[model samples]
Target: MTALVIIPTYDEAANLAWIVERVLAAQPQLHVLVADDGSPDGTGAIADALAAADDRVHVLHRVSKQGLGSAYRAGFAWGLERGYDTLLEMDADGSHRPEDLAQILAASATGADLVLGSRWVPGGGVVNWPWHRRLISRGGTLYARLLLGLDVKDATGGFRAFRRETLERLPLDQVASQGYCFQIDMTRRVAAAGMDVVEVPITFVERERGESKMSGAIVREALWRVTVWGAARLVPRRLRKGPRPEPESLASRPGA
Candidate 1:
């Protein structure tokens, strides 16, 4: 099964080259597509250089800064058009270990429709993060699980793999969340579609280079979006999910 890993970036030049090399080294057949949003720090130029050197490396340059949701949506559509059987998401920073890509793919091959590299699962942990940061991440995930009723442990995780069929069946065009909330958006969609989702242990490390995009705005977005989704689900189905798009799976919906 062919796989394509999508790495989204904005001013990630410091870590871009290193991350790309590590990803390619992890699996010889693994193809990488760097989706960059016109970073002023010459990140796009660096990506172009990498693509020029390696046939397996590709680049998608957006004219301006778009949210992670849109970047992944574009990358997914690109991979689907070219007929990749499996697609994956990884951050540009070093947080997502390239070595773990093997485990994620192995899980997918063993019949998992989606594989999440969860830091909260048994054998999973983080490196170099202080207590409060860990609390924020774990807390946010916990709050989301409580509100959304998702069975997954790390609902806010970004490291994930998906079979192409799963993405096609999901309402990709309708996803609106951008920040960390994008993870929750797709997680809910996967559960809503009743796909076989699995979680694997992965060590998430704090980025040694580049600034973290996580901020008050991003945190607020996750809180607000998750809260709104939870409240909407509490409403009667006749006024909510009943009128949505067609060909979309709703087997996991409430009272479906």
Candidate 2:
């Protein structure tokens, strides 16, 4: 099946080259689209250089850092237009392993609409995180699952694969959350759509370079947004379609 990996970046120059090389090596057939939010540190230029070196690598340059949701939305639109059968969202900071892409693709081929790289599962774990950071992540996922009535163990995970049909069906424009909540909200919507979603255990390694973009403000935004989404769902039929388009044919392109 054709696959396209969408990686969003702000100022990830330090890790971009290695991440891109590893992903390409892992699945030579997989095409990559880098959505860079005009980084002052030259991330966009770096991505362009990579794209120039490899035909399978593509780059989308945004004017500024408009948040992760917007970047992914743009990338998804680009991939959809090209007729990619499967779309993968991953961090450019190297937290997600390139080796796991094959597993996610395999899961999608097995009838799963969405496959998440889960860290809370039995075979998954976090590396290089402080105790407090671990607590925050665990607590956040647990709270989100309970409040949103989701069965997913890692709703906040950024690493995920989606079938082309699933992305097309999801209402991408309606996605409101920005950071981590955006991930949770999308996963919950997928489950609500009666699509099969699965979690594949993955090792989430902390970024070794580049400054973390996470902050109190981003976390607060997630909390607020998730609360609103959860509350709105209480009305049952009030939920609108997600920000993604309906499933489209994958025959238009060779890779996702």
Count of backbone clashes, every candidate in sequence? 0, 16
Name the weakest run of 10 consecutive residues (lDDT summed) in model 2. Answer: 234-243
> Total backbone clashes of model 2?
16
* Candidate 2 local lDDT, 1-256, one digit each (tens): 8899999999999999999999999999999999999999999999999999999999999998899988888999999999999999999989999988878888999989999999999999999988977877888888787677889888888999999899889999998678887888789889999999899999999999999888898788878877776777665553454456657778755685
- Tens digit of lDDT per residue, candidate 1, span 22-117? 999889899999999999999999999999999999999999999898999999999999999999999999999998998999999998888999
Number of the top lDDT candidate: 1
lDDT of 2 at 131: 94
Measured by TM-score, the strongest candidate is 1
TM-score of 1: 0.91
Candidates' C-alpha lDDT: 0.93, 0.89
Tell me the lDDT of candidate 2.
Answer: 0.89
